[model samples]
Target: MSAITLYTGAMLQGAVITLELTAGATVVSLIAGAAGAVGRLYGPRTLKAFIFGYVETIRGLPAILQLFILYFGLTQFGIDVPAYWAAFIWLCLYGTGYAIEIFRAGLQGIPEGQHEATAALGLTRFEAMRRVIIPQAWVAMLPALTNFVVLELKNTTLVYFIGVQDIMFHARLGVSNSGQPLAIYGIAALIYIVLNGTISRVGGILEKRAAIAS
Candidate 1:
């Protein structure tokens, strides 16, 4: 079989794995990010401090180190984690840190009077955030969140380091089988480009809709 054909056929499973990891990470990041932002913005002083430290610490580390800690380093200490779950958790945690910052910036961008206005209307803090603040913040953060989603998708390739059967891992397999590293790697790169481009287009559409809505 031609190298391209071989690589394409073998990559199906890897592609599915990539999608699954990306979807899981995206969901985790959104939920965790929103919570983190809310805590940092309005929670008690101690909670805000804790959240800040957490975000800063995670953001400071390279994601690959985080993956290595979960997959390899932890095992040495007798805390064995499965490779797939390790990747999932690491990406979610890594993405959550950035997501929190994105969301926090969105929240901070809103005028303070809006919060006061919600209070003036006798809305509780929770209700005010839900009804007034979060919607607008979401609109502001959508582009950044979309970028993170794409980055998380691309970062799934890093799972290959821990032996997760992702696209890059399969590409390596194709290279081994076909002895055509350049062609196989080219196909892998194209696959990544296509995936990221699709996400960028979707994000553009969403940004326009948000602009019109706002």
Candidate 2:
């Protein structure tokens, strides 16, 4: 096989792993972020403090360091975290910090008068949030959230550090076997470019639809 053909086949397999990891992390982060935003905004004092600290700590720390702690550091205590789960949890928590802030800003952008209006209609807090707040916040939040999603997609490359067989990992393997660092690494970079480009395009489409609806 030609060099290009061989590289393409291996990179495609790596691409699948990359996509699966990104999808899983995105889903977990979104759910966690929504709950975190809600709790930080309206929960009791202790709950707010805990959520606040979690978000801040995650945001402040380097994600690679967090992954190292989870993957290597924990082994000292006999806590064995598989490479996949370690990467998964790290990305989820890391992405969730930004997700919480995105959602919190979105929620805060809603006017207090909206809540007052909902109350005037005799709606409960849950009803007000469901019927009035969250919908608007979702639209307002999409652009930032989309940006974060793209970042998370790029961040999946970091899994290579932990020995996950992601695109970057495969590229490194190809470099070792084929002795062509530029060619292998270039292919990996191109794959990332394509994936991130597609994400940007989809995000734009969603934003347009959201704009039309609002």
TM-scores for all candidates: the values are 0.94, 0.95
Error of 2 at 40 (Å): 0.7
Error of 1 at 95 (Å): 1.2
Top-TM-score candidate index: 2
RMSD value for candidate 2? 1.3
TM-score attained by model 1: 0.94
Clashes of 2: 0
lDDT against true structure, model 2: 0.89
lDDT string, candidate 1, 89-167, tens digits: 9999988888899999999998999999999999998899889997898798888988999989988999998899999
Off by over 4 Å in 1: none
* Each candidate's clash count: 0, 0
Write candidate 2's Cα lDDT for 39-137 as tens digits.
999899999999999999988888788889989999999999999999998899898888889889999999999999999999999999998998888
Model 2 Cα displacement at 11 (Å)?
1.3
Worst 10 residues of 1 by lDDT: 1-10
